[model samples]
Target: MTDLDYRLEDFLSQVELEICEYLNKQKTKFPNSSKLLKRFTKRKDDWIHVSNHFRELKAKEKLGCKENSKSKEKTKLQDNIIIRNNELAEVVNELCIAKLFVEDITIDSIEYEPIVFKGDKSIDFHLRFIDGQTAYCDVKTIHPDDTGNWEQYQRALKNKLFPSHASFDLQQDSLGGILWHHSFASRTKMLEHVIEFEEKIVQKAINSSRKIMLFCGDGFRLSKDELEDFADFYYTEKYRKDDFMQLMEAYSMEKEAIILLRNIDYIAYFERKPMNLEYKFIPRVHGSASI
Candidate 1:
């Protein structure tokens, strides 16, 4: 095998080993009736399958068991599982993105979850380019809500939009809400949310003379079958690239959020696959457009 292939295989092997060790530790923590315990024991060895499996496990855990136990105790345990599982998925995404830059002559190296400043939040990656330039990328998983809660239902009712991706048709209805298309609508909404939420990080990157990047994960909770055809199943196939680019260009000029959008250098998207990163540049302008 090539050096790059070996490196990837080694990295994946190490990750699987770590997961096994963690499960071994959890073996004695819960009772025989614990669903989480059963899940860990039954987890498949496939990398892609395991990723989606954890998410499914999380969803099932949320539905929870009806056993007679203290409410607080069950809530606490469930919360901990959710948080820990999320961390696993986040780390996987970071590592996969890092692999994209491996062997690229332009990038000298990548530091995962680096501490950029003292007493401040850290982005997912810090890339040192060979030409003495640097960039910071923060990876985010973008997925639709599946809680089916009353509040979510209310919001869907008001907005007339929801998320239900089976055949990529917006005609589907679930709980009295029309499914929202990820490529057509969610992409813009996700970008707006990121700008609002990561304002400080973007500002800090700008202040420090560093290029800012947002790596948004578009593939989340996809089934193994869907992942097999991920290239066509992902957001790109649902809409035109030029049309979305035009939409973003227009949205970037809005008066209120122009400052934030102008400073964000790059916004990249991926389908949870190695070497599949796609860049979507957010244009920087001197001034905002008038209302």
Candidate 2:
């Protein structure tokens, strides 16, 4: 719904700072969903696709007037602003993490949206360590979805395993979908990625020197009951503290793996822990995310 209250906003590059400012400017346009979706998509019908349920609601009315069309279009838009804000929210979330990441190692040399070698995998931000080491970084903002998330699963893994899909050739650069997370989805899905990785690719991320970090936008931040429901669904099999601890331990053994869950006003940093370590900060406006 909003952004983490991040200090040092200037840490963002000029372009990124402009992007954030642009989002701020567009907040004035927020109450309008049709125009918001248009800002994101070039196609006229794409706006409807983003808020298709509204169309169904309008259709169900059995009677529609052109005079009310404009009002009706803007009606459901406000309630669904989160959906409209996904892409932009992700970029802002990444900028927040990038600032922290850059300061962590105190590296000044940086590049944004660079292509990685061994494949065409594009990183959100690339950094050259002070020691002259290089790491490919990708930022993710995962949300709670019940649609089986098969769509992202398919897109993330399709090319890695399917060779005949020529477009995948560009994606073959040691890319993997199995996230080493303070996993939001739980073991079944993570295990599926493990199985798929072993079946299609041989590289073990834990064995590599690269650092992988996952940043869950404010979208992933949930209240107690919502978290419980999410856990019930995510850990559909069992909710064992011991199992989760073991998983976190495994993820931590990696060189520079981090899993952060941040909200508009607080951030919960998880390394190897039964629970996340949380800290409060200023609250920024809320928004959305994809992967």
TM-score top scorer: 1
lDDT of 1 by residue, 1-291 (tens): 346435554655664454433433432221221232233333323333434444555465579843454454456555554554444444555444444554356877666555445464456566777788877666665544343334433544454343232223223345323233334234455555456535756546444436444434445332222222221212222322212133333444454455433444544554553323242222121111220
Structural RMSD, model 1: 13.4
Give each model a TM-score.
0.47, 0.36
In model 2, the runs with Cα more than 4 Å from the true position are: 1-82, 116-121, 146-209, 217-241, 244-291
RMSD of every candidate to native, in Å, equals: 13.4, 16.9
Candidate number achieving the greatest lDDT relative to the actual structure: 1
Q: Write the per-residue lDDT of candidate 2 for residues 1-291, one digit (tens) a residue.
A: 013212212222332344334433433222222232333233323333545655555565656644566566657664564454444444445544444554464453555555433453344455566786654444445443322333444553443422232122222222323221223354333333223323222232322324333334332332222233223323233333323223332343243453322111111221111111122222121112210
- Worst-scoring 10-residue span by lDDT in model 2: 266-275
